[model samples]
Target: MVSTIGRSFNFQPCFLFNSKTVDKSLTARGHSWLWPTAAGVGATAPDRQIRAAAEQRPTWLPGLDPPTYLDGTLAGDYGFDPLGLGEDPESLKWYVQAELVHARFAMLGVLGILVTDLLRVAGISKIPVWFEAGAVKYELANTGTLVIVQLLLMGFAETKRYMDFINPGSQAKDGSFFGLEASLEGLEPGYPGGPLLNPLGLARDIKSAHDWKLKEIKNGRLAMVAILGIFIQASVTHVGPIDNLVEHLSNPWHKTIIQTLASSSS
Candidate 1:
């Protein structure tokens, strides 16, 4: 009876072997009657399943998966790391802080450039152009002394920020510089929260703070692009961005960016 059953069913004693061994044997022998699911009957290991899941995951760019390190926790994260710079966790942390700083500066720079140009055009102030202001000769004596003082102040602040980044929450809050308290306690590493920083209580909670950060990063990115374009336009046309805009509005067909570049090259 046993011999008849074995001969009729083609039973090869699969119970004696492990699942992986059975799978390998069946696959080697061109047999796939074991597993009949969508995952298929061959090579359904945990790593392969993980890889499939990653492939199915979507990113900012369609049909592409985000990098493994960038799991969409940070604000403004769109998986746009083409150069793979943020592969290491430590380096990525530092880079995130640095990018925030640069973005903030770029936002401020765009505002300053636009306001300076607008004030000049409206005859409110006769200040030099934003790019050329450094070369302007001021009437104040010892301008070099003022520059040195400004540098010292800015350097001190930057050093403090850098130290905070390196050793988080290590700076003392009891110290004062020239009657001004140099305290950044009870805040995030980069954000020095106080009335001066958040007078309107815009970021009252964690969720609100995260939303505000997203908004800030988006606007900061736009401002960075705007400032870069402004620099290029100023260098090419030797005019402020506001003036360029006026020219374009005055004559849309002939005063376009391409035409301006062509005329400048000519």
Candidate 2:
């Protein structure tokens, strides 16, 4: 009777050795067989939903087109025009170049100071070996001061430019809380100091600006971070506490790179 039952069922001793009939039998059980399929669908659904949400995410500040840089060129075309002393499209290109130059000089000045401090701590007094310690110190001090001033100026100018761009039609309306429409309770959309100053619009612009800044940092400014990282690493290795906060604030990849290079060379 057992042999007849076995013959009727085509049973395999191990799951690994199960035949098509067993699989078919399992599928015939319905809910139990569908569990894994359901689980897989459930697992993938969230990811698909997330992607769809990202795709559908609305962008504010719709009309602004921020300049992009590639290979030290504005939109991969224009060259150096640091003073913005050009005409039309050239003026726009020069603005980008000037911004880049300003950033570069600022980074250079900061790195120079940090590196010099590191060198001094390491008993390497002067960089050239010919210049007096006093002279090198004086040079660095003056240069750092000048660069810092330039950086501050550039920052102020850039902020003004950005503010103008974001609130082109009416700066007073968009940025300030207490604008002309703020007094009017019945002000409608598309009017100056009306919907522009409303919570939703302000939130959208703020979010857009935040995203734009993030994109700028992620894309064009990595080299600045990396160059600054070298200074941080040098300070950490030799000078100690001075760059500790900077090292902590900066990404771990820089530290990893510095350590790996040190190890490989040693």
Candidate 3:
């Protein structure tokens, strides 16, 4: 009975997992041996030692199951586990649709602004200068509003995506701002990870979560650059100070250079 109990307590009291040592030393030890430490003397079995160590873990740690390190070694600090978050596919679908709508709206708004600018700049047809300026300003204002909406939508999408990553099982209720009900079964671990208890399955899910983050980073870069460019163009074209500065840039040397070239050609 003592030997059986000692075998159950078989654990290595170390920060790093060393399977060879743990199995050879802790597992092989019986109740006849005892673990002596600052905590106190206890059964040489790994399980009792692990419990003692876990009881000493800092209370400030966040998340559930502060104990249970992936490796056989005891965890000195809290570890990340995406499975802690319960499954909910509806929230994921809402975010996907929200981002899609924002992307489409942003594309249309930018195209409208660009088309208006092209008509004025190309001078393809006679139109009053004031009318063209007004049209451009109007489009700029509308586009700016759309851009702000896109920014907000992107922020929301990013936040939701992050939450989803941290907790794969999360779900949103029907009729939320994100959209109607939808399933996010793909995000769930059972599909990609295979089984809950398998280490290989857990690793796959973790890797997939990281991949999603990478995709978001790329999308964020593109959206930021496009929005920044739009704002810069609007400022350069419409701001009175910038426009006046460009109009007033003059150099007498330009005329002199042209005249000198003309004389030489003659």
Better of 1 and 2 by lDDT: 1
Ranked candidates, highest lDDT first: 1, 3, 2
RMSD (Cα, Å) for all candidates, in order, is 12.5, 20.4, 18.3
Per-residue alpha-carbon lDDT of candidate 2 for residues 33-131, written as tens digits (9 for 90 to 100): 332322233235775564344334322222221122211222222222233233255455445545554555556655665676567546776353211
Q: For each candidate, what TM-score against the reference?
A: 0.76, 0.25, 0.26
The worst-scoring run of ten residues by lDDT in candidate 2 lies at 1-10
Residues 174-205, candidate 1: write the lDDT tens digits.
Answer: 55334233323326666665465656656646
Worst 10 residues of 3 by lDDT: 1-10
Instruction: Identify the runs in model 2 with alpha carbons over 4 angstroms from their true place.
Output: 1-152, 168-221, 237-266
lDDT of 2: 0.42
- Candidate-wise lDDT, in order: 0.71, 0.42, 0.42
lDDT of 3 by residue, 159-260 (tens): 755555566545344543345224332334222222332334333454445454335434543554565566654454442222323444554455343453
Query: TM-score-based ranking, best first?
Result: 1, 3, 2
Model 1 segments beyond 4 Å from truth?
Answer: 1-58, 176-186, 206-208
